[model samples]
Target: MDGARLDQFDRKILSLLQADGRLTNNDLSERVNLSPSQCSRRRQRLEDDGFIKGYRAVLDRDRLGFPLVNVISVTLATHNRDNAQRFADLVAKLPEVQEAHALTGEMDYILKVVTPDLKSLADFVNGVLLPHEAVQHVKTAIVLQTLKETSALPL
Candidate 1:
């Protein structure tokens, strides 16, 4: 598909699903003013078209004992696609790396990490990160407070 052409109904369905993905088909149908079967078909089409990737239950990080959040800036040894993809693949395997971005600036990539405490973060930087051949430098900023956190994407 070139791009997902979203209509009003698609937008509404997406808004409701982002808030609560576990909503029953009947309940969602009622909310969107569509019959259950029609709503199901639309939802299925959306999934197949790649608009709705997957439904998942949100988990509490604090309750899960992962209380620390850190934003890490990393500079790579090179700016080639192979080097970037290699770093990205390594980042994908690290559970603590929640988000990673390739940017057009001094740094190669920025990573948002979540761990239990400073000790774990130290271990990750020393044991896991510094040892990487592609990684040139890393700087970390510990989050004192979180102003906002949301997964909703504007339609």
Candidate 2:
């Protein structure tokens, strides 16, 4: 639903869900000052309208044996739909690629990658990304520190 259609309760529900997706209807209702049934219906409507996508647990990268995060800038070998599609398809199959976005700047695309170590990151860049036909230039920068990272939006 559009932002204009969301009332206070709806906004509260969205905010609460963003903070803790595992919150039960009883707990959510208590926080939002609504009955559990009303809360459940509102939540269902929110999900049906696509405001709330599927829920997932945020995993710890360090605990999962992935400690290195890298920002990679990729330039296509040729500027064409086929090349872009090939690159997209290649990244879609790679589990190390956390996020990828096509951009309008000097770089054709930017990727957020997580790896176990520097050697793994290098192997991915040299063996996988650079060897691809769609890729021309690849620049990578390791993240030294994460000052801020969040998935929640301001409602």
Candidate 3:
């Protein structure tokens, strides 16, 4: 639903769910000061209306063997729908590329990539990204420290 149509209770429900998606209906009702049935109906409505997407557990990359994070900027060989589509097709197959964004600036795209180590990162950049016909230049910066990382959106 649109922001204009969301009541205070709806906003609270969204804010609380954003903080913790696993909140049970009973728990959410208690926190939001609403009846359990009301909470359930509202939440279901939100999901039905495409407000709440499907949820998944957030994994720890470091413990899972992918510790290195890199922010890579890409300049495509050409600025055309075909080239952009080709680049999009390439990134879609790469599991290491966690996030990809088409941008408007000096660079055509920015990628958030994760790898196990320096050698693996090098192999990915050299063997995969650079060899792609659509890529003209690739610049990667290894993340030494992450101050804050979250997927939660502000209500």
lDDT pick, better of 2 and 3? 2
Q: Which stretches of candidate 1 lie over 4 Å from their true place?
A: 1-4
Give candidate 2's TM-score: 0.98
Candidate 2, pairs of clashing residues: none
TM-score of model 3 vs. true structure: 0.97
Clashes of each: 0, 0, 0
Across residues 55-145, which tens digit of lDDT does each residue of candidate 1 receive? 8888899999999999999999877888888788899999999999987888878899999999999999988887887898999999999
lDDT of each: 0.88, 0.96, 0.95
1-155, model 3: which lDDT tens digit per residue? 58889999999999999888899999999999999999999999999999999878899999999999999999999999999999999999999999999999899999999999999999999999999999999999999999999988787
TM-score: which candidate is best?
2
Model 1 lDDT-worst window of ten: 1-10
lDDT for residue 35 in candidate 2, whole number 0-100: 98
Model 3 CA lDDT for position 129: 98
lDDT of 2 at 33: 98
Question: What TM-score would each prediction reach against the true structure?
Answer: 0.93, 0.98, 0.97
Pick out the ten consecutive residues of candidate 2 with the lowest summed lDDT: 146-155
* Candidate 2 residue-wise lDDT, 80-108, digit = tens: 99999999999999999999999998999
